[model samples]
Target chain A: MSTKPASERATPWALVTPALLWTLCFFVLPFAAMALTSVTAKDGSFTLSNYAQFFENPSYWRAMVNSLQVTAIVTVVSVLLAYPLAWILAEQVPERFQRLALMLAVLPFWTSYVVRSYSWLLVLAQNGVVNRVLTGSGLFADPVQLANTRLATVIGFVHFFVMLLTLTIFANLKQLSPSYRKAAADLGAGPVRTFIHVILPLTLPGIVVGAFLTFVLAIGDYITPQILGGNNELLMPQLIMMQIGRRGDFPLASALAIILMAVVTVAYLASARWLKIERA
Target chain B: MRAFAKILATVYALLLYGFIFLPVVVLVLFSLQATQFPIPPFTGPSTRWYAAVLADTRLTTGLLHSILVAVGSSLVAVTLGFLSAWGFARFYLPGSAFLRGLITLPLTVSYLIIGMGLLVLFNRVGIPKSLAAAGIGHVVVNLPLCFAIIYSQMGDHQINIERAARDLGASEWKVLLLVTVPVMAPAIFASFFLSMTFSWDEFVISFLLTRFETTLPVEIWNLLRSGLNPKTNAVGSLVFGVSIVLVVAFELLLFRRKQS
Candidate 1:
């Protein structure tokens, strides 16, 4: 690179300084503060008991287990449900209506996020739509307990993420050149073989990106579990919220948050190769 | 075999669509129930709940607070995002990639964690929880998104125009304001709109940072926790209706202009 004068070098810095300062003061500083608090005890001495509490307590560790299990299930189910729908839209739907179809798919996403979860509560409640249908159709003799269960929580999450994954996977499918299909056919591969060997692998990056997002969001969410999970089991977010909201226990909350962040960081590093923001 | 495959795909798509629309459809339908509960056996198609929502001063005040925070946070986020995006794209800076990564690192972290970190920091610093504090949390969440979107759209085509403006004896500020900003208006608008959408809908940060004077989502959370009422449904349906209008307008005005 050619050497630039002092004024030229200073201009870029001037332009960038406000953002850097904001990120430093708010983002980085807060993170450091949290990390510090996570190690500090309530009595003011530095201790790792806040984190050790997570390891020693059965309920605390159980919340982590529940979070991971639900997140994994939601991610897998959403992707499985979304991929075929994305394929149908990109491959079989007429071109002129594709935009409309895609818009409809994500339209519900514009609803209030809190409302969306509460709405699912209504749909899965004891006297809600599904239960009413079962009883009316004589499929069951009694109304089932659907609301306030892990199943309801999973249903709410999968509903949201299926829409997200569809958008991503649909974009990936559309990016494929028609020639890939033609070449496969010419090389004697049928439609199923071509899709299995060529299309699915090509779209894996999109799937991984969507699934990673689902995992992070679902794992850290408090509302879906707080509203729908019905106190049957605790998730990490709910446990963290309880510490601060009810007990005024900042140290424990901070420690739990750090642990949750560590899990998300691991998920990110696993999917880092496929998650290129510039290219995406 | 081909026809069978097409039939199977059609049935599957319909089922998925049904699943997707079920809750929303139920939400809207029961929002009009004349009865107390927002559940089954539709009663009168009443306007009582909607009237109740409009009459409630708490809900109305919360709506205004939400709009204020969303607009204020989004503006600050977009301005900082646009300037930094321009700098990174136009200039050659050492460790630019690393710095950019640092700025965008929050996108990978959960909102709950970010809210917790801010809560801890604020508690230590004696900064009382308020709408302004929540707005800062929102900006922290949104600044990265704005930066990424605006940065991606700054391409080489705009560079030539900027260089030409400079060679014509325009000042650096003048060239940027007159030439570069004009060309990047589409991206700027997109980022601002997107930021507004996120800040408007964001819940966790606002919930954690605000006390009594809170945003609509927190207020709605209170309402939800209190009981199951058609009033909550009415407020939710109202929000959904307004959001749909804005989204449609964005799609028509911004997206169509860009496409053409």
Candidate 2:
């Protein structure tokens, strides 16, 4: 790859220069500032105070734990709901319906995330539609206080993410040969056995990727929590937002952001390793 | 045996579809509700909120600002992305993989972080936060997406075609303009539309980076935070409607091209 002529080499660099410059100016430089800010003190000198503040505080650690918990719950729920839907879309549906279904799945993502979160707020508020219907239909005696709870955050995350998971898994499933299933059945494997032994293993890569993607988005999400979590929930991203905007504590916010980046990076690395294992 | 699986599949599909569309349905319905609260006791459908939204000068100005920024940023980003992608595809370069990774790194970072980083950098450079800065911020965020889309579409054939053109006595610039670009037109168009959508819909950077000149989403956020109003719903519906139309138009054009 490196044996190319100098003129040849200049072309690729020329092509990449604009993109590289954009990243350097906006992405790399900004992050470098953020990292510097994270370590800087109120006295305008370099210090470990921000990191110390984040690590020493139980509430900060609690927010991190809460982020992980919510992300994990959403990832699990999304996968559980998405797997069946993906299978249906990939296998049972006709081609025309499949395209329509896939479009419908992705269409919601095109809308404003804030608008979507607000819709959830409307649906899950005490006298919101879900409770109103439940009470009207005699399903529940009282309206559930569903908003601002951890449950609401998790539900919103699942709602926002399940589509992406289904799409990923569906794409993976579409590539599998149908003959493999038929072959399994002919060899005396029942539907359940064939699905478990054959289909499940093959789709593991999609599951891992889908799960990681969902988890990453969920963990990094601030808008959903701010709108839906009301006064109670204080996730990591929300904490970082507060530190930066409300509290005007740039150092603390930078520290919190770095922590979040580290955690998400670790999770992504683990998922990448898991994907390798699945492939092997 | 297949009957049971088919039944299960239908049920799953319906449930999934319901989950995806439920919020959108609610949004459209609630936009029409006379009551301030999203839950409806059925007062009656009215265009009162739409009237209110139309009357708000701030929201109108915000919408105009959003359109300008989205258009400006997307145009710059897509053009640069196209040129860079052409360079990469035509020229053999060391560290191309590293370059690709660097381009994609922004997508991984939270938008909030990006916003913060940009804010800090702009502050250091003594550039006041404004609409122009916000547009630049959006360009940074979207450039990678445009590059990836264009580069992938350029494909392996781009190198051969460029080489052939050059060997056939075309200048480097001429080969790029004539041979490389024409072939990558669809990808370029796709990148433009994608970048437009991204810039149009982006909220966080625009929200953080602007003071007086805000985008549509920032206006929507302010309205939502201050109070629940029908006007907000009206604006939401309008934005959603426009995006849907644009997406459908693009899809139709692409589909027709595929058929022909």
Candidate 3:
């Protein structure tokens, strides 16, 4: 690069300064503040007791375990449910109708997310549709408990995320050249074999990306658990919120948040390779 | 076998569609209940809950607050994003990659963490939680998204037109205002709309940062926490209705342009 005049050099700085300052003040500074707070003790001494409490307490660890358990269930279930739906739309639906079909599929996503969760709470209640159908059809001896459970929470999550995964996986499936399938058939691979060997591997990136999104969102969510999961159990977000909301304990909340972030970091590192763009 | 497979796929698609729409269907259905509880056995179709929701001062005011925060924050975010994106795309700035990464990093972090971080910082700095604080949080969450969208669309193709304008004796301001802004209008609009969508629906940050005047989501949360009532359903339905209108408008207007 040639040497530029001072004024010319400052132009980019001037343009970018406002955004950078905002990011620095709000995003970076607060994160640093949280990091600092995480290591501080309640008694005004520098101690890792906040983190120690999380490491030491069974209940605290249980909150993490519950979060992981629910998030894992939601992600895997969403992927499983979404793959075939995406495949059908990609392969079966005519091109003319595919866009319309996809639009309809994700239409519920337009609704407020909090409202949707609350809707699920009602839908899964004892006298809600599922139970009513079961009893009305004599499929069940009596109404079984469904509301305010891990199953309900997972169902609510899977509902929202399945649409997300379908979109990602549908894009992945559509990106496949028909020649890949044709070539596989020419090489004596059956439909299943072609799908397993060629299609699945190709779409893995999309699935991973979508699943990663689900993991992050579901784990950090305070609403879904607070709404549907009920007070029976606590997820990481709930625990973090509980610390801040009930106790006004910033240090403990910060520690829990950092731990949660560390989990997401581990997840990101694992999926980083697949997420990278190919230059070609 | 072919017929059977086709039938199977059709059934599966229908089932999935039903599953996807079930909650929304229930939400709308029960929003009309004459009964107090929003759940179970169909009651009389009543418009009273909707009326009640409209009449409720807190919910109505919260809706206005949501609109204000969403529009206010989105404008700030989009302006900042557009400027930075233009600068990075056009200029030869050192460490630009690092700076862009810094701006985009918040997209990876959860909104809850961002909210918590802001809460801690605000507490430490003695900045009282208010609508402005929540708006700042919204900007923090949205700025990255807007920046990424605009930056991605800032291709080299536009540079030629910009250079032509500069050669015609247009200053940097004139070039940006007339040439660059017009060319990048689609990206800017998309970013603004997307930012609006996110900020409108966003909860935790606004929930934590604001106390007396909160956003619609937090208000709905308050209603939900108070008890299970059809009025909550009515409010949910109302938001859903407005969102659908916006979405349809976006599809017909913006999406058609993209396709063309």
Estimated TM-score for each candidate: 0.97, 0.94, 0.97
Model 3: per-residue Cα lDDT over B40-136, one tens digit each: 7887799989999999999999999999999999999999999999999999788999999999999999999999999999999999999999999
Taking chain A of model 2 alone, its TM-score versus the true chain A equals 0.93
Identify the runs in model 1 with alpha carbons over 4 angstroms from their true place. A1-5, A273-280
Q: Estimate, for each residue in B134-208, the C-alpha lDDT of model 1 and write its tens digit.
A: 999999989999999999999998899999998899977898899988999988999999999898889999999
Residues A17-93, candidate 3, lDDT per residue (tens digit)?
99999999999999999999999876667989889999999999999999999999999999999999999999999
lDDT by residue for model 2 (B20-137), tens: 8887787778788777665666667977788888899998998899899999999989888888777766555688778778887787777777888888778767889899989988
Residue A158, model 1: lDDT of 95
lDDT of 3: 0.92
For candidate 2, lDDT tens digit of each residue in A108-200? 877777777777777787877788898999989999889889988887888878878877898999899999999999999998899999999
How high is the DockQ of candidate 2? 0.65
Model 2: CA > 4 A from native: A1-11
lDDT per residue as tens, model 1, A138-233:
999999999889999999999999999999999999999999999999999999999999888778877887888899889989999999997889
Docking class of 1: high
| Pairs with backbone N, CA or C atoms under 3 Å apart (clashes), candidate 2 | A15-B84
What lDDT does candidate 2 reach at residue A268? Answer: 82
